[model samples]
Target: MEYICSVCTGAYILGATGLLDGKKATTHHLALKVLQEKYPEIQVISDNKVVHDGNIITSGGVSSGINMSLYLVEQILGKTAADRTAKTIEFVH
Candidate 1:
């Protein structure tokens, strides 16, 4: 199954479940340090708004959730479908 964490805090759930162990992930910039400290097994990235490792998709925050959504749509459907969805939602990306 695919997992999409809309915000940094949501990653905690995945981390707690050991799904993020040894994988590259990301969260809100403000929580980057804490996330890293909390889950030393996870490679918490701070420079990305979104991180996709295997079936897991993690975003930094609410705004980045848009990008993550589009990415998921693109992955599941196609770029055209994702672009159409973004356009319908009036999202730039």
Candidate 2:
């Protein structure tokens, strides 16, 4: 269920939706600690490249959105598809 893409502080919205409760999630590094303190129900993760917990996929920064997208493609469409997508898009990572 990694189809969801919640990036940076945008996870705040998802958190408000109650979708992040009890789920390991992440957001901008600057907001990581506060988001956790603000929502103890959410197992906020930080200092990672990306985070995938159940249906939610969160990126820690703007650039991490690409990594998160690649991760989602791999989860939903297979690694080969993800690789192809990345190659086709000239993704360096």
Q: Count the backbone clashes (under 3 Å) in each candidate.
A: 0, 0
Alpha carbon lDDT at 32, candidate 2: 93
State the weakest 10-residue window (summed lDDT) of model 2: 1-10
Runs of candidate 1 exceeding 4 Å displacement = 4-6
Query: Candidate 1 residues 2-90, lDDT tens each?
Result: 66565767888888899899998998888889889999999998888889988788999779988998988898899999999999999
Q: In model 2, what are the clashing residue pairs, if there are any?
A: none
lDDT computed for candidate 2: 0.86
Residues 1-93 of candidate 2: C-alpha lDDT, one tens digit per residue: 326768889989988889899999999999998899888899888777589887778899898899999888888889999999999999976
Every model's TM-score: 0.92, 0.88
lDDT of each: 0.87, 0.86
Model 2, TM vs. native: 0.88
